[model samples]
Target chain A: MQDKKQLITIKGTREGLTLFIDELCSFNEAIKELHDKIIKNKPKKDDPIVSVRIKLGNRYLEDDQDKQLTEIINQANGFKIDSIESEVIRKEDALKWKEDSKIKAINRIVRSGQVLEVKGDLLLIGDVNPGGKVVSTGNIYIMGNLYGIAHAGVDGDRNACIVASYMKPTQLRIADYISRAPDYESDGVYMECGLVDEGQDKIIIDRLQVLSNKRKELSRFERRVQNG
Target chain B: MGEAIVITSGKGGVGKTTTSANIGTALALMEKKVCLIDTDIGLRNLDVVMGLENRIIYDIVDVIEERCKLKQALIKDKRFDYLTLLPAAQTSDKTAVTTDGMKKIISELKQEYDYIIIDCPAGIEQGFQNAIAGADRAIVVTTPEKSSVRDADRIIGLIEKEDMKEPPRLIINRIRNHMMKSGDMIDIDDIVQLLSIDLIGVVIDDEEVIKASNKGEPVALHPNTKSSIAYRNIARRILGETVPLQSLEDEKGMFQKVKKFFGIRA
Candidate 1:
């Protein structure tokens, strides 16, 4: 039992449950150790277990090795594969990954007939004029006016929201729901954020000050399973 | 190698051909050896605009098809010894000239000339692709209308997506001062704000543009006409000269001056 605990260390992370496979052992021993550990520490009814992230730790596994590793993880009753990450990634690959998560700031007027897409939080330092669009999978912040379509939560994350300087969006969409304000020009030049309301399941624009404390700029959501 | 620039406009009739002819002529006037290529193929007008239609014995199609030498196909301008026009094939279509063929021709031209200006065919198609293929930079043209500005915006986006290291410059043409003063036209500041590209030059509405082109003479050759000066300023800016934009409004004559003195606005 002591050897089993040393070979496999499991813990909860912001990105769901993570299991560390100790590199001090053989592949079969590691798998056996992980299987025994999971069986003994089975998730209780209130633990809200969904999936698992396996840390391979400096080892880049081949396709067959990954398949064998996944089969062992599958043996644990409730958890499925979230992802497999090697901590000490190749130098070039690490740079590429850093680029993907970086906040892309486009410092020009988003003109009509132009569409800008970003992976994470987008900082458009210029106005999105009529007929232009700014779409992102995560949160979007516009330093200038948002006169056009601004859609956040494109990949259906309800927490994602859009903050615009003018707040008068032609059409605002967060996740699956869309909101249109014909009279937004009345409030005119105020800064606001568009978020999905948890109560009504509709999109609402609140004052920017209220939502400032809950921003997740670089960290994407860990995979979550639906409640049964 | 000389800089190769493609002149493009997504919508037709915003003066892409005229700009190419005048810019090339202006550069040659400044003593730079300039070659202008018309990639319009079947519907070519650049040769006619430059007044080199009758001198086209061998066309670009001939050089690309390996039937004639490059010098044989280039029509030398009689006015300026340094300017040359590579006429598009009148008898053939865009398919006659491949993008790779254009790159090869442009690379060869780089060794001989100081500037290689390509007059791209309107619209984003095979002809546009072939023209922009060999270009080191791009110059997008547009007029003062919603439709034209929208098209220019799209063209600018396409240019930015290209592998060229520098973003395309914008040239606003045919701006009418009276319409602008009357609030019926989109002004330069508004258009520049919407397009969000570098503004190289602006051309005012003048009859000299139409009359000069009819005689197969570019406005830049005239040098004294209002539109001619505008085109020259554009050329100077392209040569890295920072010439301020000239106002399109007409100066008040004696009668209007007297009216203004009498507290009556013209």
Candidate 2:
């Protein structure tokens, strides 16, 4: 006979029942104690037991451990546990990580004709040449030359910025606005381009500076162009 | 050593079948026992290109389903002693030849032939899959166009997913050198940079290729044609020779330009 306190600890929350076991207690012992407790604390016949889940710490047990838990829950009398229903819920929750935005770092030159689409920020350590596309739902950061077409904030976040060491892309799109490299003179040096003021509609192409000197020149250029 | 090479282009009208026929004839001329298999099933053209359509009584489907023996189905090339053709079935669909079926047939033929070149069909469907099933290496054919390069890129990804031992080589076909030099066409470096694959061959756009194909003989079998020379160089490169890529700029000189303008015979 096992001690009741060493067997199991059951807590009911809005989501479902969480069964915990004390330190040094095997899963088999916990199962036996859970069966005994359910039999002793039987509620009204109309009120049914909804679900039972076991937790050790943060990570959930998979494969055989999941099977063992399901068997224990199904064996309990006066309440039927639909193992398949609970399994589906568990699987959906397990795959939640894939739905969240992730940062994918590609460390090679993306050649032309290659299309790379990611739901989060994309960081490339190499060049993105012509015919190659890098599209992201979030920001796009390239550590090397950006010669290909890129679309950042594809899901419509206008604040998204496309930053590259050398920006000479054939086409660039931020949120909704699309801009192509000027056909006359293409500045091949290291630069950055993003949305500026006036309803965040205009694209400002400028060199990167730590002390904001380029920002002042950009503003001066904008004012002169507007006044002229 | 024998190699199983598949000539594939994901998009249609990119000259995959034409390249395969020419390359097979070129390799056969080099004294290699080359067997060209048309895995396009119902849309077979390799037999017609090789001018052996009348000789193909038993097709690849008949060999796969054990209806006929392998040797009975193989059509010997009329021009080359070392060349043969395995025609695809015009009556059957793509499903008639599965990946496993292709593997079994190719592995059996690998022992006899010095080279087994498969002419893959267009698209990334079951026919394309079956065509590349038993290949030791692959050559993706593409024209100097955006759509062709895009499809070739997708096919490269699919080939990588199959876990091939080596990267699939690229062959840029039908390049019009004058257009490229005049900035109207994409350059070789542009394509090589975009596809990110090693280039094995580059064939110039030539009228002799069309004329020869219409005559049921590949341009590669023709003596002194530019496209034929390119195909022979490609075969030598496949044999591990260090052949230099022909400079399109150098070939655009006064005489060559005049020849190109007049559609002069090579």
* Local accuracy by lDDT, each model: 0.84, 0.79
Query: iRMSD (Å) of candidate 1?
Result: 2.3
Clash pairs for candidate 1 = none
- What does candidate 2's lDDT look like per residue over A1-228, in tens digits? 454455567777675566665536665676677668777766566776666555554334567966776666666544444322221235665343343245679887665567788876688888887667899876688998788898987877665567798888888888887888887965675766554334546656655552154234332323322221
What tens-digit string does per-residue lDDT give for candidate 1 at A84-197? Answer: 877665677556555434578889777666889887568899888777899987678899888788888687777778888777677888878888877533555588888887
Off by over 4 Å in 2: A1-104, A108-120, A127-138, A144-158, A165-190, A195-198, A202-206, A209-228, B249-266
lDDT (tens digit, per residue) of candidate 1 on B136-167: 99999999998888788777777777899698
Error of 1 at A31 (Å): 17
Q: Pick by TM-score: which candidate is best?
A: 1
How do all models score by TM-score? 0.72, 0.67
Angstrom error of the Cα, residue A175, model 1: value is 1.4
Docking class of 2: incorrect
